[model samples]
Target: MIRLKSPSEIATMREAGRVVARTLAAVAEAARAGVSLSELDELAADLISAAGADPSFLGYRPTWASTRYPGVLCLSVNDAIVHGIPDGRVLRDGDLLSIDCGAYVEGFHADAAITVGVGDLDDRARHLSETTRLALEEGIAAVAVGGRLSDISHAVETVARGAGYGVPPNMGGHGIGTKMHEDPHLANTGRPGRGVRLREGMVLAIEPMLIESGRDRARTARDGWTVLTGDGSRAAHWEHSVAVTGDGPVILTLP
Candidate 1:
């Protein structure tokens, strides 16, 4: 069943979202060419713990995965799209690293992701990351009390495709609250007027994952976790957990 959050519950989620936002910001700032992905993950873990929140991605076992997730953050570098495990791999000067993470606090959960360039990047890398981030902003703006759910999807799709980027069909956002993933799976591409009608108390994680230069599809690695671009082009992902309110669409995951 699709769950609606109360104002008080949303308030708690807002706190969780703050923890997530702060942690992600810290990780992004700490990312450097010489740092390993595991080091960044560790930094996020400590930040989440110090804030009295738990890492939502740690040991999370989705039904589609072969085993429990082992990282605090999904650090996807270059062609790796999402769910990229953190290890000893050192970042390079021109790599694009996608950091996806979540935080849980007081029984509520918030999820968000960001793709950043490790150092000096080419035009394509900067364009892909910036375009993907813009798509997420447009998707968040689409949330309205009486609008259809796919309105957000359409907004995201339009921004991505118009920029000549490709979206991974299987990897998208979802409803988020007590659980990291919930009912009403949200695709990046859909008809605007279709799907569930948006309600005042509904909260969703709106994310856009765009592949480099319009390839249209990506591939999953053998780990049954990491997603990859098909044409060997770089990819970028951006996300935010948002709530539909009487006032407007309020982003919970902001710092």
Candidate 2:
């Protein structure tokens, strides 16, 4: 069922979103060559705890996964697309790292992700990241009173595919409130004016994941969590949790 959040619940989620934003900022600032992904995970856990929130990704076991996620952050590097587990692997210069994080506070939840270059990046890397970010912006813009969910998906697809990028078909965004994942799965590509109708109080995590080679599929990692490009292409991901209001869309996960 689609859970519509009340104003008070949205406020609580905003607080959780603040913690998530701060955590991502801190992780990005610390993301450099030689730093292990595990270190970033630890940092996220500490920051979330300091903010009086819990890491929503920790111990989360989706039915599709083989086991519970063991890290506070999903660290996808280079060709890895999403659900990348944090480990002892050290980052390197020119690597693209995608970080997905979630925070739970007072029974509400906020989830977001960002992809960044570790150091000097080539034109393709920068282009992929920037395009994915812009795609996310487009998706978020589609959220408003009386809008359709597929409109957001179509908007995201237009931006990424227009840039000659590819989007993983099965991997996209979701509704979020009191849970890390919720109803109304937002696809990366879809027909506009189809699917659920947008209404006041509906909160969603709209993310755009883009690939360099225009490949539309991904291969799961041996760890059962990380998902990488099927064609070995570099990918980028960006997301934000937003709420549809009577007037317009209110972004709750802004830093």
Q: How far is candidate 2 from the true structure (C-alpha RMSD, Å)?
A: 0.7
Which residue pairs collide in model 1, if any? none
Candidate 1 on 136-196: residue-level lDDT in tens?
A: 9999888998999899999999998899888887778899989999988999999899899
Best by TM-score: 2
* Candidates' C-alpha lDDT: 0.91, 0.92
Per-residue lDDT of 199 in model 2? 89
Candidate 2 residues 1-255, lDDT tens each?
999999999999999999999999999999999999999999999999999999999999988887999999999999999989899999999999999999999989999999999989888899899999999988988887898999999999999879988898788899999778899898989999999999899999999999899979789888888889999999999989999999788888888
lDDT of 2 at 247: 76
Per-candidate TM-scores read 0.98, 0.99
